[model samples]
Target: MEKRLLGVIDATAFHEGLQELTLHRSPAAIPFGGRYRLIDFVLSNMVNSGIQSVAIFPKYQYRSLMDHLGSGRNWDLNRKRDGLFFFPSPRLDHPVTGVGPLDHFAANIDFFKRSEQEYTLITNACTIFNTHFFPVLEWHIASGCDITAIRKGGVSLGMYLLKTSLLRELIETRHETGYLSVRDAATDPNSPLSLCSYPYEGYAAMIDSVDTYFSASMDLFEPEVWNQLFPRERPILTKVKDEPPTRYAREAYVHNTMVANGGLIEGTVENSIIARGVKIGKGAVVRNCIIMQKSKIEENCIVEGAILDKDVKVERGAHIKASGKKPYVVRKGTVQGAWMNS
Candidate 1:
């Protein structure tokens, strides 16, 4: 069956360190893994899974995102049937008030209505992981599930797969009511139908749960709010294996290593993730960090848990680590442990 995956590029700066870097740009444009941008991970996953049509939802600060993801050329996403399309937020004439994933998805409800595919996969942009989505789609269909949420076991990677019809129903119901949280829809027994949580356990569990199926519950949301919806005997639980060694950066440094040119990396390092034209002096030790394009690191500098914006400089013997959790730069000969937010 023809299947289309909709990769939603949500632009919220969810991480403190990443938010600072994306002050001028969208989070999707944040550089990661030495060479690739954060959005590359999600986009690449879609491409690798043979999903041709993809739309990026850029809500705020999208210029850089637009620049990097130009026509989706880099990931072979440029074609007659396949290419990256940008979907902007609905205007006042459209008047979409609240902001949430469902709202964003509702704004682009027309895309779903027009799509010819039988299955649709919705994923967030910020998560960094590698998986072929076709299997997830297959599991969704085989289970006779109306909605199948793709969840990682240990830590939620925040992905899901739902039937096009179910998504349409959710959007329509929420649009009439002016609110939609996955927590609310999955629990209401009086609603259209129940949902199935596909536990991403080991290979056997993955196959069995897809075959047997289980009910979805409010466990997916905050515990305090559980009473707002109905409770189920045992909600479906998917066990997802640990993703690749992924890092989320708050304040970090990296130097002179090859980053695979896509995704996010957190923490500090020296002589690692160094793309072309990056220079680090002999005495410079970069610890817990991310370095982007052509940035230079100077000598005798002890840099710790800091993100060096492009072309940032640190002179000799400058010890720089900031506390208020913002990525800051240290000029020449400056020995400071904390920085004042300007």
Candidate 2:
């Protein structure tokens, strides 16, 4: 399947509800699971499924995305032959609706024409899952379906598998077909394409909004969810950051939390995910939060039901809490002083 299947990830779609987190970066580059970026999950899934030739289409603030991916060496995609390819949209001002827009693909049609892969797996960069697409490919071939959309419980997971030739046809004749994207073509009732759904009975979550993102992050605490996502055989890969193990101070107290490397814990933490290089000062109490990489919480602060983005600083004696409807999002690289407590 490595030689036969090609992976194309659409990283351009933006959700209005996630604006707080995506103000400075593309949605695909948003940090997740303490260490991995949002795109890492799907990209790793493709690599783990033996797809060597992968292409990423990104738009709107992709500098961070490029910085995170670099040469795709972390996922072992840097190769002399068909390796990782990146294509940014030529028209950044155009509005894109779905996962794989035909116009964007049309911009770089030569890539598809030159590729030797027999089939293509097009997916969104946001859905979190660990799936083997070879089985889906086999199912698509056996069923003689023109397009196969991977679904969980009858809901589309924004993943599709189809022939490379058919994808090219869709891209070239998009205006005539009146299909703006693969999603539009598959979901349209009047389309001539034979569409099928491959039911995936695995753990999958599409992070499109703040609520969904927070819910998925909290779900990582479950043992079953944790095992399903990070199994030993199909590990989720990410950029390598060499850091020492997290250090816990004598005054620190923690329980039921996931703390990444190079963090200093001096306060109390519960039911949270702490990323690398985070610091929790003495007398701070953090619970039900996702503290991103290099964020800090000073002494005597109380933070709960919040998401502190990368490099955020919570000043001393501050108290921040959610309203039980949505997690309080502290934007990236900002400071939360005591006067601004909520």
Candidate 3:
């Protein structure tokens, strides 16, 4: 069953308003939901659908992406045959606006040609959602189209389920000036490719901008969105870490916060999402914030409507807030001192 379907993760497809999150990594590598990278959602979707053969082609700043996905063992994508493949991660320079996943497909044409899977699923790595692809694949097989793409929220998620031979043809002919964007090729009226749409009703979030990222994080405060993402039947998979339980001191006053494993909390946290291994000292106040892994909020500091990237440090008594509008993002590995305004 696994060999019949191939999964492709185009790691460089989308990045806009994500300058802060993508400074050191691609958009797919952006951390979300406290414990999972943005790509984890799509990868989990692929694996949970019973597809074993997965190939990921990441663009520049892909080391972190590689480190995170590893061999895809956590998703049970590790096998001698029809297993996970981390394609050649070449560092590339492009126009200021950058190109789409066309390059990814062009470079991996050999892989597409070699795979035995009858159908291929290609997706960008920046969408946050939980969905099973098997049903969609079945519909695609029945529809008899060359491609069946998931359409929701007035936008195609850059997710396509295609016949393997058709995809190979697209890639082989991609050198033509007009065929670079897969969307254009699929939708062209004169083209021989038969493209159709598959409706998707599941909860989905496409993170193209910083505002979307922040909003999606806060959306977790709603039980519905949280349940949609962290569904009981299929879990979002990521690389595991070995750390002790989060230790909360008696002084910790946490309310309405989703704190991951292995942290030390001794502060006032309300309406915030705290990642694993974070430290909130006594007297610190965090409100409406998303704190990433291993960040530290010292005593007396106040963070409101902000996002703390991984390994950030906020010195004592500092203040960073968005005033109920924009959310200030503390870039990865930033260290703010006593006097700070953001």
lDDT of each: 0.53, 0.93, 0.83
In the range 246-335, model 2's lDDT, one tens digit per residue, is: 999998999999999999999999999999999999999999999999999999999999999999999999989987667999999999
Candidate 2 vs candidate 3, TM-score winner: 2
Ranking by lDDT: 2, 3, 1
By TM-score, the candidates rank as 2, 3, 1
Q: List the candidates' TM-scores in order.
A: 0.67, 0.98, 0.94
After superposing candidate 1 on the true structure, give the runs of residues whose Cα lies further than 4 Å from its correct spot: 1-8, 12-17, 91-100, 181-191, 201-256, 259-272, 321-342
- Write down the lDDT that model 1 would get: 0.53
What is the C-alpha lDDT profile of model 3 across 1-342, one tens digit per residue?
A: 577789888776546588988888888888888888999999998888888899887766888998998877898877888778987444366421222356666666788888999988888888888999988988998998887878896578878888788777777766774666566665677877787899989788889899999888889888898889988798999989988989998998999988899999998999999999999999999999999999999999998888999999999998887755788888999998665445
Range of the 10 consecutive residues with the lowest summed lDDT in candidate 1: 207-216
List ranges where model 2 is wrong by over 4 Å: 339-342
| Residue pairs that clash (backbone atoms under 3 angstroms), model 2 | none
Clashes of each: 31, 0, 0
Model 3 worst lDDT window (10 residues) = 91-100
Superior candidate under lDDT, 1 versus 2:
2
